[model samples]
Target: MKNSIFNTILVTLSVSLLLLLGGCAKTIVPPTDTSAMATGSDLEYPESHNTGTMGEAGFSEDNLPLEGSLDDNSHSFNDTDIMNMPEAFRREHGRSSEGFLPVYFEFDQFRLSPEMMVVIEQNAAYMQSNPAINLILEGNCDERGTAEYNLALAERRAINVKRYLTNTGIPENHIRTISYGEERPLFLGHDEKAYKYNRRVDFIAE
Candidate 1:
């Protein structure tokens, strides 16, 4: 019994020593791969993504845009881009129309009326203050002309206004053109007064 107890104590000491040694074992990590790999257009591409533009806000995560790129150039945003932008983002929206003038056109034609020089002066003032005002012209026509022809004429009128604005120093990029034709008459009458008012253009913010 004495020999057995001595042997058992020795065995316990050895087991404990083995377990303590194991607790201090060091973990070894393999070296990472470091080779001349390609990148920045040189690397193999996995697959392409189709980025799209937004109808409301221009850009949003829901679009699932590609890694990075311009989606489209269809924004009809004008001076109103500044006005329509949320208050928090108004500062970076584009330009202000504080001193800019509201341009005017002729009575029967879409061309800038000779009397509109004052209106252009006002627009020039507005432009002086706003500096970055984007202009969108929506040409309109009276009910005297046919719908289709009127649409084309209205477009021409808007284009004519834009051309003149550009001649006045406004950048062409800042002005966009569209026509309303005879569809949207300003006055509800067949008289010359109403026709005069209807044959005009409107500015829209994107």
Candidate 2:
């Protein structure tokens, strides 16, 4: 009978030990679902995304200047509009006497001559009167040099004309420049008459 009682007490002690060990055991919480946490508070978004603008990556159309907005003078001519420009202004080689006179340059020179400066001043005056008109400075060159060299020279001529116009209170962005080089000559010949008409910057109004 004593042995039986001792066995019962031993079983009770074993049960108590098991319960104490279970109470002290650490709880395994399935690693806290770190994958969802990684995508939540720690996720980084692009600047455009944060602003809720519609565009891929960081490019947003809201940042672009509005069309016909004169405040910034941000206007651009598409290829179709350029193609529809007057043939006389596009390729005809001649001096304009009245409105938007062509600014002539010396052979292989991009500097604005005193006479050319006067022409630019007149053009600037015209632009000041019509603030909404956009201008295109088309630089040309005689067909005497390599196409590449003439193209670069023509570009310089256009830029110089643009600089002069900007100094005269015209918005810099209102003027667009293009170099025709020897591709579009008013006079199509090897003589000075042809070269004289070809080496000029023509103003096209839009």
Candidate 3:
């Protein structure tokens, strides 16, 4: 009788152990990706309607707003920020840069292609009409290269675009250049198409 009781107890303990392990297995989770986050920015995905070249990725606080993000209520205000003006700023960079057309770039190259040249000409026309509007020549890259290299490359792209603009009479002071490096990408896919979209510069109004 004692042996019978002992066997039953062992069976019960085994069942309990199996249940515990199963529970633990169900609770286990994979690690999260924190690379997309900027310093002091929220660890989770931010609530953004930004569907620019970055596509669905939110521009963390580290990105700031190129130069032209304005407060929600007004237009062409330099100190105004976009967050305060999310209502329409999402549609256009707003503030100093309303009606500005943001351009995309190819991966790892700083030269504006023939198509990009057309964009630059359009911007030249708008800026010529609106002198107080400062330009933010923001550059971005994909996640393939070293961080430092990507940053330098992005800067170069911005410079390249600025050179074109300068030749077209856009003053040096009118455009400010910034490089986001490989820290931002339009799509998270590891492919040629996504990489191409990421390796470009953005134009913001200040």
Name the top TM-score candidate.
2
Predicted candidate 3 versus true structure: per-residue lDDT over 110-188, tens digit per residue: 4455676777788888889988887777666777655655665566566667777887898888777777677645445
Candidate 1 deviant stretches above 4 angstroms? 1-108
Writing each residue's lDDT as its tens digit, candidate 2 over 1-206 gives 99999999999999999999999987432111112111111122233322211122211223322122113231233435544656565444243323577887766556566666777898999899989887877777788666655666676667767877897899998987777778766665789866777888878776
Better of 1 and 2 by lDDT: 2
Q: How close is every model to the real structure, measured as TM-score?
A: 0.48, 0.54, 0.52
In candidate 3, which residue pairs get closer than 3 Å at backbone N, Cα or C atoms, i.e. clash?
A: 67-206, 68-205, 70-81, 72-85, 76-95, 105-200
CA deviation > 4 Å runs, candidate 3: 1-97
- Tell me the deviation in Å of residue 13 in model 3: 50
**Model 1 clash pairs?**
77-206, 99-125, 99-126, 100-125, 100-126, 100-127, 101-122, 101-123, 101-126
Lowest-scoring 10 consecutive residues by lDDT in candidate 3? 49-58
Best by lDDT: 2
